[model samples]
Target: MSIDGNLLTLSQWLSPAFPVGAFTYSHGLEAAIEAGWVHDVVSLQNWLETVLDQGSGRSDAIWIRSAMSDDANLSDLDTLARAYLPAAERLREAERQGAAFVKTVNAVWYTSFPDLLLPLAVGAAAQRQRMDGDAVVALYLNAFIGNLVSAAQRLMPLGQTPAQQVVSAMTPLCLRLTVATRGASPDDLWSNAFLSDIAAMKHETLQPRLFQS
Candidate 1:
């Protein structure tokens, strides 16, 4: 594929219009909001930045690089991703979305690699489509962060203006994360967001939840 083609594919994957159901999972943002850790726009923004920096931005990006480089043991990576998810609901959410992404990509394109976790599938698809690793990483991070922001907007009373601001604020973080993940290894894929994980676990039993995790 040409560079333009790769970029276009990345755009499609990053778009909210994609049918992978990424918008359904808040990655614990909903639970956080419900717990009052994120009540307003500023707090929400801070919470999201922390998540990006400490959790998904670092861990997922590391996994993405590993998947793209073919340095990841698929079974081990899958197991770790599953086990690392502290909540059953969160685990199911990732697997379900990952499966959906795999199926959708396979239906549209031919690839030897399937059964990838969400980040792995995205990185592999980006590589197969000939996207540069940096661009691929950036797109994945952007999409992930954007989806969370959208979820926040729904879960909270955040207006469009604040949501857009949140998205804008995340751009540099995504770039930095992409750079940091460029040569990251599977061993680097770890997170310390215990509270987020606990909240997700608790969310499984929370009454009247707005998100799947």
Candidate 2:
């Protein structure tokens, strides 16, 4: 496929309309909103910046890049990805979405992606398709952050324009992380987004929750 064709495929895989059910999971942003930790645009941006810089956002990107390697150990990576999660809700969030992504991709593209975490599943698929690693990880982060921004809109009084602004503001940081983590190994897969971890844990008990966590 041409370069344009690869970009088109990546865009579709990471698009909001993908069957991965990404919109259903907010990575605990719902709990943060309820707790007033992210009640406005500034706070939301701050919260997201931390995640992208030092949390699952960063770690998940590493996982994706690692999985995109030709010699990637998909089974082991999936196991580690499951264990690296901080909360059961988070594990389920990654697991269920990943399963859906794998199923849809397999059905449509005829690739074999075992049940893996969301990042690993996406990585393995991208590897098989010969997509660019940096672009794959970058767009994965974009979709990840985009979904959270979308969730914030539904959970709060945020408007479409502002929601877009958040994603826009996050683009450079996402790209930076992707660049920084290039050629990174699983040893570099670490997340210190503690508050987000707590939020995901707390989300399990949040009453009248709007997200699946």
Candidate 3:
């Protein structure tokens, strides 16, 4: 596809309108907020950057890279992605969104790759549809970050403009990571956001929760 066409495709796939149930999960941001680790815009931005660089987001980027490549061992990758989730809510968030994304893309995009993990499914679909690999990674990361930020907005005193500003500020980092992970393999999938992982585990018991995780 032309560059414009590819950009349009990514916009559609990553749009909030995509029926992926992404709004239902916070990726542990709620718990972080509850714990006061992410109470304001600066803290939220830092938290999201950590996720994008060293947390599950980075791992998912690697998975997406594998899925978009010809040598992807999808079943094994799926298992790894599943086992890599640090907590139950995180696991549920991935699986539910993965299933929804797989169903929607298969029906709409007209291919039937197994409805596996979210990152893998999206990577497979991007490859099947011949979307630009870097664009796929960048767009996917942005969507993931955007969803979490939206959840934060609902769960805290964050305003719309600042939430979007955080996203905008993270764009360069997103593109840089997309480039960095371009040659990544499934074996490289790992995360180091210990605080986020802990938050996800704690979110299971967090009271008065507005998000699933």
Candidate 4:
């Protein structure tokens, strides 16, 4: 595909209407909000950036790179992704969204590649569509974070301008994460955000929750 085609494909995947159930998962942001860790716009932005930097950015990026390189070992990467989910609800969210994404891509972009986890499927799609690896990774990361920010705004009372600013502020960090993951390995996938994990775990039992975590 040409660069224009690649850009269009990236836009589709990164769009909020992609139908991968992204809007349904806040990656625990909703839980954070209820817990008061993300009561304001700035706190929400910091929470999201921390997740993109210390949590998903570090672990999922490594998984994407590993799956891209070792197609035969995709299962191992998937298993690792699964294991990294410290909460039951979070695990189910990842697996559910991942299966949906893989099915969609297989039906549309049908390659001989094996079924992939969420990050891996995204990476594979980027590769097949000839999108720039770093660009695709950054786009996905930002979109993922953007979804959380959007969810927070709706769940809370964050203003439109503040929400957009939060998303804008994340751009540089997304670029840095994409560049940093260039040499990352599967073994590098790790997160120490136990409080977030605990909140997600607690969310599973929270009465009347808005997000799947």
lDDT measured at residue 208 in model 1 versus the true structure, 0 to 100? 90
Candidate 1 lDDT for residue 62: 78
Give the residue spans of candidate 4 off by over 4 A.
70-72, 112-115
Task: Check candidate 4 and list the clashing pairs.
Answer: none
Q: Considering only N, C-alpha and C atoms within 3 Å, which residue pairs clash in candidate 3?
A: none
Candidate 3 wrongly placed segments (more than 4 Å): 1-3
Candidate 1: where are CA atoms >4 Å away? 1-3, 70-72
TM-score, model 3 to reference: 0.95
lDDT of each residue in 1-213, candidate 2, tens digit only:
445688899999999999988888889999999999999999999999999999999999999988988888899888888888899999999999999989999999998778888899888888888998998989989988999999999999899999999999999999999899999988987778899999999999999987889
**lDDT on C-alpha atoms for all candidate structures:** 0.80, 0.91, 0.88, 0.77
Looking at model 4, which ten-residue stretch has the lowest summed lDDT? 64-73
TM-score, predicted candidate 4 vs. hidden true structure: 0.92
Best-fitting candidate, measured by TM-score?
A: 2
- List, residue by residue over 1-213, the lDDT tens digit for candidate 3: 445776787788789998988888999888899989998989999999999999987888888898888877788889878887889998898888889988988888787777688888888888888888898999999999999889988989989899899999899989999999979986676788999999999999999888888
Ranking by TM-score: 2, 3, 1, 4
What 10-residue stretch in candidate 2 is worst by lDDT? 1-10
lDDT of 4 by residue, 74-192 (tens): 76777777777787887777677777787777787765556556787787667666667777778888888788888888789989899899999999998898899986887677786
Which pairs of residues collide in candidate 2? none
